[model samples]
Target chain A: MIDAKHLTKTYGTKTAVDDLTFTVRPGQVTGFLGPNGAGKSTTMRMILGLDAPTSGTVTVAGQPYRDHPRPLQVVGALLEARAIHTSRTAYHHLLALATTHGIGAERVRQVLEQVGLTEVASKRAGGFSLGMGQRLGIATALLADPETLILDEPVNGLDPEGIRWIRDLLKGFAAEGRTVLVSSHLMSEMAVTAEHVLVLGRGRLLADLPMSELLAQAASDVVLVRTPGADELGKALAGIGATVSRTDVDALEVTGPSAGRIGDLARDLGISIHGLVPKQVSLEEAFMDMTRDDVEFHASAGSAA
Target chain B: MSALETQAGATVPAPRAAPAGPAGPARLAVRSHPVSTRRVLLSEWVKFRSLRSTAWTLLAAVVLMIGIGWLAGWGSNDSWAELSPQEQATFSPVDITLAGYYLAQLAVSVLGVLLVTGEYATGMVRATFAAVPRRLPVLWAKAALFAGVTFTLMLLAALLSFVGGQQLLGEHSATLGEAGSVRGIVGVACYLTVVGVLAVALGFLIRSTAGGVATMCGLLLVLPTLGLLLPSSWQEHVLPYLPSNAGAAFFSAAPSADSLSATAGAAVLGGWLLVTGVAAAVTLTRRDV
Candidate 1:
């Protein structure tokens, strides 16, 4: 389990992570969602003790990361940067890290094979393609067989097959009762893979909701109605606490009231209805709606096009 | 076995095998060892030897040590007949034997800087720190492994230079038994070891490659030359303490006027290194990676 309480990180006058308090429990994948520069990487760095938190404390299992006797064994983090030296072969790089914890060469070979990097183990990491490098990074993270895996944008440059491979790997890790935290700006991907999400916007927590809960709350399940006496029907629906959004001159999107109830009320009121359809809310719209107010950089070029 | 593919057989657990222990369920034991200084030292040795640059730099230092010393001895012997009476009377065979160290120290020390700074330049420090989050072991391991290798190898180069140089000197040659001869030879290797260690400390303090190399050059090379422009009275008090000038006293056949004795010079160089080391440790532990 990873726990961060009141964590804040600031660079000069700009705050990167502001007073974040959350717990990442084991047995599930927690998605860290944020736009670029929204503090996901900084928070991960703080947890790994790479960067000091400007204020507050973060711990893995219990104590800070530095206090762990076997840090690599406790947390395996694959940050955005490809941390391998470009000139060294993959075998040597893994061996160097393995030796630090008195880990044997056998474990190194196992991890290399585990990541499908055994074939290229002798090759210089500089020559590996983007997907290969990502695999190598994952191999290093698994070298110690860590209990908590924190991956930052693990699917950035992967093919569809590779993406599915990582998704299954993450699910497997979680099923093994390991804590898995995956960060990504890709909402569609996170919607499918993550069971719980911690969304950040402008360095502050915007939403800390379960995936199913968020999807259900964003679930449109709304009844749309068109009638000649729309004004009278709107007042009656409002009296029943159903939220009515005027979508057109004669149509309204009604929430809270079931289609059967709205139809019965309209018929009893003697108002003729032209259309009564329930609108389904897409997952993409739910994610966009949550972050719509949080996107710091407006896309001027895309808007222009 | 294919990567990530487990054998579903009865021979093995077919999944994560658990060690027999009470730490958790008789399942996934998560065998992991703690970081040890010895392991870090071994890891550093692996890093130090794997790079193409490490091989080339060590080779260059060895070649420079033997090549320049041999050339200096040969040149001195060839000019013996043309030397005036006073010049002949003042000639010292020991000086010619270790002359290559002046150039070789640059090569050895720059390699020291690269040993640590190269990781930073290539974004490998993150991987390094991620493995050992306490951070200082990485610095200490680099320094220990680097100093150990440099001292061992450079000492051999110095011995070779001395043997080859004395041969070139012919009748004018000095034996190791001669006054100040062994000191001149061994002192050059000792001085280079100190230089290499100081460069490693400077590398951790200044993470940038260009900056670390430039600072090393300024400390060992430029600052000493700049000392020449100092007023003569201040030069006697200040120049003798500069890293290069003090290191110069170590390999000299006799202590020059206005400079510290060889013992004092080594101590002064050691002092500079100690300060550099402490500063490096403090900065490394205090700063963010």
Candidate 2:
């Protein structure tokens, strides 16, 4: 488990991660979600003790990451920035890190195989493509078989196949009872993989909820009606606390009411409908629906937004 | 993709293997071992040896040392006939054997600085600090490993240069058994090694290649040249105390009256290194990556 209590990091006049308090539990994959410049990397760095937090603390498994007997063994982190010397071969790079915790060369080879990097184990990392580099980073993270895993955008540069592989690997690691915290800006992928999500907006915790609850929150029935006289129909059907938005010149979208009610209201109003279709809210829309209010809330409070 | 063929779950993947439960794999220990100093030292050594830059840089240092020493010896012997009796009398074979340091120190110092600052340039410092969160052990291990490697290689180079240059000098050659000959060879190695360690310290303190190298030059090279602008009395008192000059005193068999003694030279260099080392440790520990 990883616990961060009031973690804050400020750079000069800017606060990167401000008052972030959350606990990432074990035996599940916890997704760290945020927009660009939301301080996901800064928070992860503080967790690993690379960057000192301006205030508060982060601890993995009860103590600070630095206090662990074998830090890598306790938590393995794949930070966003590449932390490697380009000149060294992939194998030697892992070996160098492994040796630090008294881990042997044998473990290095195994991780190389696990990450599908054994083919280029002896090649200089400088020549590796972005996908290959991500694999190498993942291999480095798993070298010690740490109990907790923190990955930042682990699929950022991976190909379709590689992305699928990492998705499974993370799931498998979490299944084995490791604390897995992976950060990403995309909500679609997290909808498929994450059990619980901790979302941030402007360095503050916006949402900490289970994935099912998040999806259900965004699952209210919203129907679309395509008609030429959208203003009259919108005015007629928008009563009773329902919201009607004109998506196109002739299309009006209705929410906060059932499709049958909207059809009956449209029929009673004598508004001939060319198309009345129920729209399924996608994960991406759900994400935008959830964060749009959070963003507006910040904008209304802070002048900088 | 093969990975997508067996879908575990829409929200969370199912367990592909049995629960790890602290007995994950054979390689993973049930309880973790502490990060010992010995392992950190080993890690540092592995890092030092893994790079091709290490090999090339060391080769450059050796080449410069042997080439300069031989060239200096050869040029002196070739011009002996044209020199006056006074000029010939002042020529010291031991000095000629150690003359390579003027160029060799540059290569050694650059490598030392790169050993630390390269991590910052490549973003590897995060990985390093994460592995050893205490941080100081890493700095110590790197400095120790670098200094030890430099000293060993430089000592061998100095000895080779002396033996080879002496053979070329013929009648003007000084044997290892001769007075000050062995001391000069060893002293040159010590001076170069200390310069390297000092460069590593400066690298950590500065944390940038351009800044580290510029500061090193300002201290070791430019400071000595700037000293010439002072009065002769002050120059004698001050120039010999500069890092490069003080180190030179340790190897100069025929020292000028104003120059410091060998022991004093070592002490001054030691003092400088000690201050820089502490400053480096402090800056590294306190600063954010």
Candidate 3:
């Protein structure tokens, strides 16, 4: 388990992570969601004790990470940046880290096989492709079979198959009662992989809840009513305290009422309703809505178009 | 094996024996032990030997020391007959035999700087520190490993150069039993070892490879030359205290008039090592990796 309280990190006058307090429990995957420059990497660094927090404390497995007798056995982290020396081969890189905790070379070979890097284990890491580099990073993280695993942007350069494999791997880790915290900017990926999420924006906790609750919150009740007499139905719906906007000549998008109620009202109004479809809000759109005001860089609408 | 075949056929790069099922934690059979100084030293040894740069740099240092010492001996012998009485009187065979250290120090110091700066350049320090989060052990281990290797190999080089160069010197050769000859031979190796440690400290203080190399060269080579522009009185007081100048006093068979004694020179070099080492330790434990 990982627990952080009042965590804050600042450089000069710019604050990266501010007042973050949360607990990542075992037996489930927690997704750390944030846009670029939103301090996900910095927070992870603090948790690993690679960076000292400007204020507050973060601990893994009941104490600060540095205090653990065997930190590799307690927590294994794959940082966002490639941490392996480019000049060393994959095998040697793993061996060097493993030797610190007296972990044997057999364990090194096991992780290499687990990450499917056994074929290129002898090759220098400088020559590996982006996907291969990510594989090596994962292999290093899994070297000690720690109780908690923290990976930053593990899917950044993975193919679809690799992405699926990582999803299964994380789920399996959680299923085995280990704490897994994975960070990603893409909410769609998290929709399938994460059971709980902690969203950050402008270095503040924007949302900390279960995935099911977040999806349900994003699920809107707006229904689309298509009828030849859309104008008449729109006036009747607006009079009953429902907001109605004409999307097309014969379609009325009605909010604040269910599809059944809207259909019943249309029949009561003597309008010939051809279709009534409720729009399903995607988690991507919901994420955009939640973080729209907190996004650091706003691409102009015209430029995006 | 069937799973591997199917994965290869399907072009899925990662395929395990089975997906880590919920049967139990994906635990390996490896035993865990606390990180100790010995294990960290072993880890550093692995790191030091794994790089091609380490072997190449050490090789260059050994070849330059022994090869150039032999060449200097041959050159001095060829010019011995043409030398004036005064020039011939001041000539020391021990100095000619150890002349290779002048060039060999560059190779040793560069390797020292690269040993630390290389990790920063490649982002590997993060992994290194994460594994051994106390952080100071790594600094000490690197210094220990580099010093050990450099002293052993350079001592061998010094001995080989002394024997070979003395052979070339013919009748002008100085034996190991001669006064100050043994000290000069062993002192040269100690001088190079301390130089390597200074470079290692600078590598940690300045984490960039270029900056570390430039600063190391500036202190060991450029600063001494720049001191030559000073007035004679000031030069005696100042030039003798510089790193290279102080290091040269103990390793020279005949201590120069303005330089410190052999014991004092070693103390001065130790002073340099102590100051830089403390500063490096402070910054390393305090700074964000």
Candidate 4:
């Protein structure tokens, strides 16, 4: 388990992580959701003891990361994809890290194979493509088979296959009772992979909720209704306390009432109902609604387009 | 055999593995054991050898040492023989062993600086600190690793330069077993290693690859060259403290009038190394990784 209490980090006059208090429990994948420059990297760095926290403490298994006897064996992290010397071969890079913990060369070979990097283990990392480099980074993180894994943007440059592979690998890892914290800006990906989520906006926690609860608490689930007599249908739906939005001359997007109920109401009013379709709430829409007021840099470009 | 063994396996309990930390059933054991310096040294040794740059730099330093000594032996024969009796009187066989020390020192110092500063330059220092989060162990390991490799290479370079210089000198040369000659060669090697370590310490303090290299080169080469341009009084007062000047004293069979006494140079070099080492340790421990 990883725990942080009142953790804060600041650079000059700007705060990067403000009063972050959360526990990342084992046996599940916790998705850290945030936009770019929203403190995910800073928090990870602090946990690794790469950066000093301005205030508060963070610990892994009740001991600070710096104090852990065997850090690599306890916590495996990939905070940056290219956090290695570009000139070194993948095998040598992992070997160096493995040697630090008195781990044998066999473990390095196993992880290289585990990450599907054995074929390119002898190649210089600088020559690898971005996706390939990310694979090497993941291999280094798994070198010691640590109990906890923290990945930052692991799927940023991966192919569809690689993405699915990571999802399955993370699921399997968590199933073995290890803590996995994956950070991403993509809501759709996190919605499917994350069992629990910690959402951040403007360097502060906006919501810490389960994935199922987040998907369920979407603003409203709408149903599209097409009717021949829209005025009469609107009156009937309004009378039943259903909110309706006009889409066209004969279509209305109705919320707060089920499709079946709306159809019965229209029939009772003698209005011909043509279309009644339920609108599924996408995770992107739900995420936007949850973080709408807290987004640090709202995409004004979207509105302009 | 299998039937009876399988029956025993089903009835008898297997030895359970040791429990891990309370984070729950961890796939890997939580190594809560205390860290030892041996582990740190092993880690550093692996880090040093894994990089191709380390090999290249060491190769360059050895080549520079042997190449410069051979060239000086062949080219300076006439100059040595043609020297006035007064100048010829000052020549020593040990000087030939160290003919390449000045040039090779530059490469060795660069190696030392790059040892630590490359991590800082590429932001790989973060990865290093994460691996050894106490931070001091990383610095200590780096210093020990650099010192160990440099000392080995410097000793080899000294031996090669001496043998090759004697081959060029022919009848004029002295052997390693000659009185005081062995001390001179070993002393030169020791001096070079000390200067290299000083560069490593400076690299940690500066934390920039180019800046550390520049500072080391300036200290090892530039300061002594500038000392030549100064008046004899100022030169005598300042030259002993310069790394290069003090180091050259170790190669000389007899101390020059303007240079520090051989014993004095040893003391001064020790002082310089001590100050640099302490500053490096303090800065590394106190600063953010």
Candidate 5:
């Protein structure tokens, strides 16, 4: 289990992670979600004790990570940046880290096989593709079979099969009663893999809840209506206190009303609704809505749209 | 394309094998040992030996030490007849046979800097520190391992250079039993080993390959040359204390008039190592990786 209280990190007046307090329990995957520069990496570094917190404390398995007699057995982390020396072969890289904890070459070979890097194990990391590099990083994290596994952007450069493989791997770890905390900007991946999520924006906790609850919160009542008489329906819906916005020449997006209610009202008003579909907000959309105001780099207004 | 297929084929254990259940083969029952100085030293040894640069740089140091020593011996022998009585009187065969360390030290210094800076350049220090979180063990281990390796390899190089250079020197050769000859050969290795340790400390303190190399070279090579611009009185007080000059006094068979004694030179170089080592430890433990 990982517990952090009042964690904050600042660099010369620019705060990266601010006042974050949360507990990551075992037996489930906790997704750490944030946009770029939102301190997900910084918080992970602090948890690993690679970076000292400006204030507060973060501990893994009941004590600070550095205090663990065998830190690799307690927590294994794959940092966002590639941490393997490019000049060294994948096998040697894993061997060097494993040797620190007296982990044997057999365990190193096991992790290599687990990550599907057994074939390229003897090759220098500099020659590996992006997907291969991610696999090596995962292999390094899994070397000691720790109780808690922390991975930053684990699937950033993975292929579809690799992504699916990592998802299963994380789920398996969780199923085995190990704590898994993965950070990523990819909400779709998290939606499938994470049972719980801690969302961060501008270095503050925006939401710390179960994935089901978050998805439920993101579910909107807005319905999309298609009709030849969209203008008439929009006017009628607006008059009845529903938010109506024209999306196409013949369609209207109506909020604050159920699809069935919109259909019945359209029928009553002779609007001749041909299509009425309720919009379901995806985790991606929910995340965007939650962090829209907190995005650090805003592409000039309409450019992104 | 064929290689890609083989890679994909190997990875497809069961295309869509049910995610490894809690009791799957994915789990390995491996035992973990606590981090200790010995294990960290072993880890560092592996890291040191795994890199190609280590082998190449050490090879360069070895070859330069022996090869240049031979050349210096041959050159001095060829010029012996042209030497005046005063010049002949001042000539020390021990100094000529061990002179290759002048160039060999550069190779050793570069390797020392690369040992630490290479990790920073590749982001590997994060993994290293994460594995051994108390962190200082890693610095200490690298220094200890590097010093051991440098001393062993450079000592061998020094011995070969002395024997080979003496052979080339013919009648002018100095035997190991000659005064200061044994100290010259052993002291060259000791001096290079200390310089290597100092480079490792500088590597940690600077944490950049270029910056560490420049600073190390500047202290050893440039700083001494720059000192000549000082007044002659100031030069006597300061130049002998610079890292290279102080180190030279330890290994130089014919001690210069302005240089410190052998024991004092070792102390001064030891002082340099202590100061840089402490600063490196402070930065390493206190700063973020």
Candidate 6:
């Protein structure tokens, strides 16, 4: 378990993480979601004690990470993909890290095989592709079989198989009762992998709840009605306390009302409906809405669309 | 104590048995073991040999030291034969074995600078400090490793160079018991190792590979050059205090015309090492990696 209380890190006049308070529980994959510069990386760094908090405390399990006995065993982290010397082979890098904890070389080989890096274990890590580097990073994170694993952008450059492999791996780790806090900007991946989300925008917590709650809190139960009298149907739906928006010249999205209700309203108004169907907001759309104000760099088209 | 919070839609696997103890969150004990200096030393040694750079540099220092001395002694036979009485009186056969100290110090200094500076360059300092957060232990371990390696290699290099250079000297070899001769040759090895570590401490304080290497070389080579151009009063006051200047005393039995006493030079070198080590520790512990 990781608990960050009022975690604030400021660099000069820019606040990277602003009074961020959240708890990452064990036996789950908690996704740390944010757009660029939303303090996701900074938060992870502070959790690992790589960066000192300006005026707050973050602890892994109970005590600070640096204070933990056998830190690698307690909280293994892969903050950077290549947080290793390029000259060292993957085998030696894992060996050196394992040596600190008195973890034997067998564990190193096991992790290498787990990550499908056994064949290339003797090769220099500098020659690894971005996907291979991610695997190595995961290998390092799993070196001590750490209880609390913190991986930042673990799937940034992976292929489809690599992505699936990581998803399954994190799931397996969390299933083993390990606390897994993974930070990534890939919402699609997060949708499929994250059990909970700690959403951030402009360095402040926008939402911290179950993914279900976030998706549910978003405008839901959307009904699409296509009719010759779309404007009339929208007016009729609005009068019935449903929020309506024009999606197209002949189509209107009606929320807070089921398709049955919208169809009933259209039938009562004697408007022949070509289509009436319920629409569920995609996780991508719900994520966008949740982080609308929090996104650091809001591209005009993405926001406007 | 462990809470498993799962997002909607994303299927979370059930919690498996904890690796060691309970099924829920496992809190770390508040108590911590006292930091062991020996463990830190062992860790530093592991880090030192794990890198190819360290191995190659150590090899270069020994090989270059012995190789250069052998060549200088062997190649200078004609010059030694033709020397006038004045030159002959000043030229000691043992002195020829110390010729490689100049080149060996450069290799050792480069190696020393890289030892500390490489951490900063590769951003491994974060991982290092995370593993050993007290900070001082890390620096201390590294210092011990650098000093130990350089000293051992220098001692070996001195022995090899002396043997090789003596072979070139043929019948002109100086005996090991000769006054000041034996001390000078062994002193060169020990002295160069000390300077190498002094360079490492400087590297730690600077934390930039190029800057550390440049500053070390500048102190050893550049400042002495500029000092030579200075007036007698300034040169005498400043030159003896520089690390290389003070360190040069270890290479000689006869004192320079206006050099510091050997004891004073040793003290000066120790002072530089202390200052650099302290300053590096302060910055390392205080700064966020």
Q: Write candidate 4's Cα lDDT for A191-273 as tens digits.
A: 88899999987678878888888878763569998888888888778888989888899999988899889888877778888
TM-score of each: 0.88, 0.91, 0.95, 0.87, 0.96, 0.88
Cα lDDT of model 6 by residue, A256-287, tens digit = 98888787878898999999887867777877
Across B1-289, the per-residue lDDT of candidate 2 in tens digits comes to 1332111111212113322333455434433358988899999888889999989999999999998999888888778798899878778898897799888898888899999998888878888888889899988988889889988999999999999998888888889999989999999999898889898998898888888888877887789889999999789878988988888778888776677888999899899899999999998888987
DockQ for all models: 0.34, 0.37, 0.54, 0.23, 0.57, 0.22
TM-score of chain A for the candidates in order shown: 0.85, 0.89, 0.96, 0.95, 0.96, 0.92
Q: What tens-digit string does per-residue lDDT give for candidate 5 at A1-305? A: 99999999999999999999999999999999988888999999999999999999999989999999899989888996489899999999999999999999999988887776777788888877777888889888888888999999998877778788788889988998999999989888899999999999989999999999998998898998999998888988898899999999998889998998888888898778788898878879999999987877778877442
Off by over 4 Å in 1: A221-282, A301-305, B1-30, B84-86
Clash number by candidate, in order: 0, 0, 0, 0, 0, 8
For DockQ, the strongest prediction is 5
Task: Give me the runs in candidate 4 sitting further than 4 Å from their true place.
Answer: A231-245, A254-265, A298-305, B1-35, B84-86, B121-123, B170-180, B226-236, B254-256
Query: Each candidate: RMSD to true structure?
Result: 5.4, 5.0, 2.8, 7.6, 2.5, 6.3
Model 5 regions more than 4 Å off? A301-305, B1-19, B23-26
lDDT of 1 by residue, A253-277 (tens): 8999889899999999999999998
True contacts kept of each: 0.54, 0.49, 0.66, 0.36, 0.64, 0.19
Misplaced by over 4 Å in model 2 are A227-232, A238-241, A245-250, A267-274, A289-305, B1-32
The DockQ-derived docking category for candidate 5 is medium
Candidate 5 positional error at A233, Å: 3.1
Screening candidate 5 with a backbone cut-off below 3 angstroms (N, C-alpha, C), the clashing residue pairs are none
Candidate 3: docking tier: medium
